[model samples]
Structures are given as structure tokens and as C-alpha cells.
Target: SKLWGACRNPWDTDRTPGGSSGGSGAAVAAGIVPMAGANDGGGSIRIPAAYNGLFGLKPSRGRISSGPSVGEAWTGASIDHVVTRTVRDSAAMLDVLAGPAVGDPFTIAPPAAPYAKLMQRAPRSLKIGVFTSSPYETEVARECVDAVEETARTLENLGHRVEYARPEFDGMALARCYLGLYFGEVSTLMDRAKTEFGARDDDFELDTRLIGMLGRTMPLPDYVRRRQQWNDFARALGAFFEGYDMYLCPTAGQLPAKIGELDTPSHLQMAARLMLLLKAGKLVHRSGQVDQMAMESLARTPFTQLANLTGTPAMSVPLAWTAAGLPVGVQFGAPHGDEGTLLQLAAQLEEANPWFGRYELLEAMI
Candidate 1:
């Protein structure tokens, strides 16, 4: 926007609303819509929610099918749902969209009760593991850290136990695996675009063309190997969940960046342009620069990818706003097929710390 190229955050015009769903986030946050559809592969939904202060949920794999036209997306890592101002809207929408279509691959166990009904009741007091720092070991903003810390304290006061812990996984390896998916997916999509839509090489953006080149050149074994490592992360997260009812962390490692803060720097852009010109995608991968670039790009959003790779239901709740009047969210993840619990707790949190007032004020100002 500058809320659809309205590129303005209604809360503050200079800051980003966030992306790949930033438009919807901006629209809804500005009260243009009560809710809007969104999806997450590598944190598309939650990232926007964190930056724009909405309630975003990424349901478990197979919770909602990708059916009729396609089976799934991004190796079944992406999930479709809605971002809303209230917990109830999300739960209600899930009720409408939460079943499998005929000829679908598989389905999650249906909620014990309707999620809309299930969420009205408060969850039992339970243990939650909280982590405030970036999983990729990036520098986390103090405000983001404070958001999680305050949430832990609040959870403690609400009769839940909170511990400073996280699922044990090689964060760097996960980043690499995610980037592997990126390369492969982009390559596939670009191929489709070129063949079906009669697109030219220069039709796409430079960064996109470069990534697709890497995907086209990537060896089969390498892609398969990356998918294989996903199970290790899932197992580790499952182990963590066995001891804890849920995991809590920063939805993002940093507060909303001012516009253009995440753009590729001039030096890197120069190098990438040359690589694009030479068509040296594999050379970039072999140089270990992929890891460096992936880490640098992912550092701001290192937290949300774990849940996607692990196929768990996760959410970003609008619980904290910074001193500068910017919103930053805290994330909560639940084990597979356990979105009911997540919704229940979200309902309770909604009551304990009502955020509806903030949105009302925002709507008034807008």
C-alpha cells in the first residue's frame, strides 16, 4: 500500500507493514478489512503479523488442503489461513476452511471440538518454553527481546510456567535447507512462467533470476538431502513439545525496519549482478556465499521457519508495542495437529491483555 502501495504503515507512514502479505496486513490493520487471506511458507503470514500487529496463524500441514488444482505447495511447508484483529475471527474461519477435500493427500485429526467452541474456554495452566534471541544467532532488537520477556512474565502471572529454552536444532543447517527449498521452488515457478506465459529471461527481477539459476543447476542429491534434514528438526521440536505444552519466542528478531532497510546492499548487489551476467548460480553456491547470504537475509526472521519446516501450528500474537509506538509480536508454536490448544491459549491471552482497544484507537486515528 503506500496500505496496496499506499507503502505506508497507518500506524506510522515510514515503517513497513511487512511482506509477502504486507498488503493484506496493512489493509486489515488500517481497518480496511476485518480479515484477509494469507499464507506462510517461510513466515509470510507471521512476519507480516509481527510487523503490522495482527493475529496471524499458520495451521498445521493438511489442516487445510491445497486441493482440486494442486496437492500442496513448497513441499507441503506452506499453509493458508487468515490474519485478523481478534482471535475469534481466526478460529471461526478455521471452522469454515479446516476440512479435507476429496482426493486430498491426507488430513490432520479434526479438532476435538469446533475450534470456535474450543477456544472460548481457557486452556489449562501449562508449561511454555520461551526463547527471545534469534535462532540464527543474529543480533535481536532489545524491543523484540523485551516483548518475549514481558510475555514470559505475564504467562508466569497467569499460572503458567515459563522456561528459557528452545528446541535443539542446528539453526544454520535449517537456514541452508530453507534456502535450498527457495532455490528449487523459484526455479520451478520460473520455468512455468517462461513456458506457459511466454516470459523472457529479463522479465523477472535480478535476484529472482539468480535464485532460479541456482535451482536449475542444483544437483538432485543436494535437494533431497535438504528435505531429509527436515525430519531431524521435526524430531527435535517434537521432543521439546513433549516436555512443554508450547514454545514462545519473538515472532521476528527485530522491530519493523524502515522502508528499504532489507534491500540488498550495493556491494552485494554488484556481486549478484555480475553472477547473474555470468549465469554462475552453482559457483555462488559452491563459494559458500549462499550460506552467508541466506543467513544474512534470514537473520531477521530466523524464528518462524522452524515451525514451518517442522509442520507445526504457530501464531504471532499482537502482545507488545515498542516505545516508538511500533508493534512487534511474540510467537507461540504448538505440536502438530494441536492448533486447538494454540487457539485456546490465544483466546485466553486475548482476554488477559486485550488488544482490541489498540486497534480501535488506530481505526479512529486513520
Candidate 2:
């Protein structure tokens, strides 16, 4: 995507496959492979699955090793697994990747049975809290709302106790913290590029440069404070899980955007260019523009970050599609280290509403 342009969805070229795992989603959806590797920091795996109509799961923190060198990614908000058309493939992949690396910082208990075995059957009588609104209080599209409602109905019919609810937390605050991670990661990586590769300011794209600049201007104490706030969110979600077996919401706040629709608009681009030219990163940060950037960049992606932030297992189950034939997915989040529950539920949904063969039908039409 850096140079080749956006990866278009195989089902409809006008729409994206979602990112940054969108390429893997596209490759799997277009039948290039049965499965491909993916990860989620803030919905990377689930976003692509929602757009491309696949089963994607983000394992709980430390369920899979982050690295042999660095202990974590995105401050433990990210973990790697796979995206697949069938739930079983994801479960099988998890079994393969589930273990402690030699120098891992976090260690999670392994599943009692392998996930492939766990996901083959449904978890009984799940009390799922369902919501369709954005945590950031932004608008969720009508179709996205409808997808969750429909799935809620289907879940109810399947004898699961479905209720309208969400975990208690400051959505905007969480957004700020998430963006803070972005700033720090971008800035640190930019410096690494300069040190490791002799990269210049002009070498990066405008958005990357802007985020990196914000990172450079960010205060270390503020970064530490924001990281600490993640605990509050984790506790809130933990409290919610006391009553709810899992949480259900739209995987994305809206359907996939038309390519380039999310790009910084011309006026903003001009403003950003001016800031970069003048090295006015702190000024922009003080102007409360970061909030605007969060809304612009993350409004559509608010749902999946809770799992990432809380180090819980979550999945996007492809149970709905729009009238235009674009896929929309419903998310299911389980308690920490409870990927087996999410996977089992996903397999149940897959059985009740089969989506695996739709691509073959699309191929026929094409």
C-alpha cells in the first residue's frame, strides 16, 4: 500500500479490503491462499476481516509471543494470529502460535484443550452485551447498526441471552491514550529509520511525518500517564464481563470507505504542511487538533480497540452484508485469555449463518 495504492476488496474493487492486514485479507479472499498471517494493535486484523468477510481473532496479550527481542508491541495492545474464511483455520493457527518465547515479558496460561478442539463446538448460554454506537461517540452508519441488530436477533434465536450494553469507560480518554501510542511509536520508528537507514524527513509520507512530529513533541510524563490509564479501561471491561460472557458490537463503525476517502483533506494537508515547515508540532498539539485527528482517523475503528487496550481476545464474525454486497461484521469479545470462548462462539455463528461459500458464488458471477 505504500507505493502500489490501496488494496481493493476482491468482492468489489470500489471498496478497500481494510488495513494494515488488508493485503492478507485480500490474498485470502481472492483465493490466493487459505489463510494468511495478521495482527491487531487497534483492529488491524478484525478491520480487514470485517471488510473482506472472514473470521479474524485477536488473541489475548501473551497468548502468542510478541518477539525474541522486544517484549511487546503497541504496549501490549497488539498480538499476531491469522485471518481465515473458516473459523477452524484460525483456531488451528492459534494452537501453533500459542506458547511462551524465551524472553517474553508476559506469560498467559494455555487453553485446557487445543483451540481447534475448543472451537468445533459452541459455548453454552452466552450472556452477550451488545452495542452499535461508537465508543468515541461518533456516528455509526445505518447499515453497520443493522448488521449488529440482525446478529443480535440471530444470537437470541440461537438461545444466547443478548442484551444491549457496553463496558463502562471514557471512550474519548481511551482514544487519546491509543493515539498517544501511535505518536510515540511513529516518532520512535522515524528516528530508528534515520539512525538505521539514513532516512530523511522527506522520506516519509505526510501523515506519517505529522504523527512522527507529534511524537517528537509529546511529553514523556504524559505518555507514562496515558499508559497507566489503560488499567482503568481494563478494569471496566473486566467488571462488565462479570455480567456478560462476551460483548457484541459492530466490528467497524461504518462500512469500508471508498479508497482515498479517509485521506487528510486538501485544507488540512495544507495546515499540516505549514506545521511541518515551521516545526510547530507542539502548537498543533495545544490547539486540540489531535482530538479532531482521532475522530477523523479512528471514528470508524472505535469498537475493536477495547480488546486491544484490555489485552482480551476478540473476533469479527462475518454474519452480515450490505445491500450493495459489501461485508460488515459483528465483533465478539471475551474475557482476558478467553480466546476459546470467542472462537467457539464464532464457530457457532459460522454454523448458524454460513459465509464461507459466498466467494465461490461471487466467482461464478464474475
Best by lDDT: 2
The per-model lDDT (C-alpha) reads 0.88, 0.90
User: Roughly what TM-score does model 1 have, to 2 decimal places?
Assistant: 0.97
Model 2 Cα lDDT, one tens digit per residue, 1-366: 466877888878878889889999989888889999998999999999999988899999999998886699887988899999999999999999999999899698888899999988778888999998899999999998999999999999999999899999999999999999989999999999999999998889998999999999988898999999999999999999999999999999888888877777899889889989999988878889889888888987789888988999999999988887888888999999899888888888899999978888666755
Give all TM-scores, in the order shown: 0.97, 0.98
What are the per-residue Cα lDDT tens digits for candidate 1 across 12-111?
Answer: 8788887778888998899999999998999988998888889999999999988877787788899899889999999999999998988888888898
Clashes of each: 8, 0
Q: Which residue ranges in model 1 land beyond 4 Å of their true spot?
A: 1-6
Each prediction's RMSD over C-alphas, in Å, is: 1.7, 1.1
Q: Candidate 2 — worst ten consecutive residues by lDDT sum?
A: 357-366
Number of the top-ranking candidate, with TM-score as the measure: 2
